[model samples]
Target: MRKILIVGAGQSGLHLALGLRAHGYAVTLMSNRTPDEIRNGRVMSTQVMFHTALQHERDLGLGFWESQTPRLEGLGISVADPGHGRAVDWLGRLDHYAQSVDQRVKMAAWMETFAQRGGQLVIHGCAVSDIDYFADSYDLVLVAAGRGELVSMFGRDPARCAYGTPQRALAVAYVHGAEPRPEHPGVDAVRCNLVPGVGELFVIPALTVGGRADILFWEGVPGGPLDVFHGVTDPDDHLAVVLQLMEQFTPWEYARVLNVELTDPGGVLAGRFVPTVRRPVASLPGGGLALGVADVVVANDPVTGQGANSAAKCAAVYLEAILARGERPFDAEWMHATFEAYWEQARHVTKWTNTLLGPVPEHVERLFGAAGRLPQVADRIANGFDDPADFEDYFYDPERTDAYLARAAAASAWPGVRGARRIRGA
Candidate 1:
């Protein structure tokens, strides 16, 4: 059996480790913490897995919380006007539902599952020297941890990296008792409230350790009014700051979360990271080559909510590449080609996500304005989260955006036809 050692047990690392184990490979998975530690630790991220990404987990039999998690059937956007009201608003139904499982709950369960399946689980933080010592023991070494000393092994690729600094000051609070949006009563949706020039607030229906809950996430433009959660360490203080910002910038959203409380002491997270893309193959001092996976290679801002999805897709792509290699050595050349294959899909995600981090283009704003009047247009945008590659067709270019909107308008103008056009609310 091919021996593989995976360091870091995040979504990509754990997914790939379990996948290789299922294939009868000798896989040793390393994590910084055990199942209990992870379960009781701080919340990791705000993830909403759409159809394709969720299907990957289902295929692996890792969708343990599927039934318990909230089924987000729609994604709605509310653009806050300068006057503290929404200038543009609409909800777009997704053909396939999306779901968010709190990383604390999901990762802890997955770690236990991997061990119960008879895979070796080592609880240790890996450094450059540690990996160098173990490089010769395994047929392949993959680094999935995107932090600490291991990341410095991979050099940054300046050409592909868009920004040298963090794009948004991010803060998250997972709370219970958030009421449903009045506009979409009884319908569960991911509400994205965009406060122009200041930042955005995303209300996501999620499943946490303490049952069903909502994530009040703020993405504040640096040095802006919304960037006020820097020193707030206490959970209650964090939620307080989050609510204050919401009331000031997005009062409509504040109405729903007035009575919300933290899910747990560790339910709040605040941090920022530079969106970067690094060289796929990292060179060690002993001339051993280690392959960087997922966020270690292509880390994009979470503005478009693609971090977890992209990591899942990267794990899937790398698994296929490993299976296809047969008896061939997992050398540097293979590593580069594997990441390139994944990048073909991931580049679209990176491009779409990075585009949203900057100022909204006029053409894209035009598209958003049109979505309120056209159901087909809104649906297309909503479903694009499932596969961001679809955006390359009509998202970036002005001509393509105009052409797509015109087509949608003409299709909605069919005369004397019942249900030919569904004009959703604005």
Candidate 2:
């Protein structure tokens, strides 16, 4: 049996371990944190798995859907003009094909399933250092070690990367028993608001276990923002500030939130700014290879919430290539080809998502503008997440640009308005 050592216990690492074991590979998954540590650790971001990712979960028979920390049937997108104190529900009840779960619960469930599948998981105290690979340590070593110092071992010149300005900082808080508005049942569970010039705020309910909800706020800080504890340090004071900010953005709807009491004293509220980076796959000296995956490969702004989905897709593609080359020498040529294939598949989605987060490109802006006026156009965009073929078109073929644009234009033009405009312009 071929032996494999996976260097991280994150989502990709865990999924890979399970996939390899199913294929009759002996795998030793190593991580720095134990299951208990991950379970009790502070919850970070929320992940909405696309249909393809969900299929992977089911294919592995992980059986995690029923125990999902939360489930959302639809998504709501709004644009808030904080300066005018007005919010427009730009897109409501869109994207019905996706579901979200707390990152913590998903991780815990994955670890449990991996262990039950006879996969060996070792929680070493810290990261593993450089060891002689050819010394017969293992047949293969896969590095899924996320974005950190661990990425440097692959030895690539950092100067070759294209870096962009840091995006806004994000602060997320989880609270329990937060009542919902009668008019907007479970609104918090699926709503995302783009407050231009400021940032975006997403209220995702039940993102954690025990009926807890997440209040995610992103602010575009070219430099940074003044430290404002949203009652995290002091409930009475921070709560006041958080409510004030919410009311300032969506007074008519969020006013009710001011009355809700925060019950979790130990609940999480934290912030950080993320810089976007993209680098080419680097080849190691000894015909071994090191390539970035997930956020490390293409760091996308969370405003689009496509990180987890993209990572899952990347892992799936990599797994396919590995299986295809069974027992083949893991040489530089094979590694380069695999990395190229993965990139080709992932580039389109990554670019589209990243562009959506940045100042909207003209084509995308036009699409969104038309979507606002056309329900069919809006539905197409929402349904695209569930249809991998549509996603591929959007990413892989620039020629489809006009087709998408035409659809948007047709949707945007009112009855009789198209002819009238053409006549007038002519």
Best by lDDT: 1
How many steric clashes does model 1 contain? 0
Q: What's the C-alpha lDDT at position 127 in model 1?
A: 85
- Residue-level lDDT of model 1, residues 257-323, one tens digit each, is 8899999999999989999999999887888889999999999988889899999999999999999
Error of 2 at 197 (Å): 1.3
For every candidate, C-alpha RMSD to the true structure in Å: 2.6, 5.5
Per-residue CA lDDT of model 2 for 93-185, tens digit only, reads: 444345666666677767777788888887774332342342146766667776566565544433432334556555555555455655556
Q: Name model 2 segments beyond 4 Å from true.
A: 67-70, 82-87, 92-96, 125-135, 154-162, 181-189, 224-243, 259-291, 361-366, 385-426
Report the error of model 2 at residue 186, Å: 7.1
Candidate 1, after superposition: displacement of residue 390 in Å?
A: 0.9
TM for every model, in the order presented, reads: 0.97, 0.80
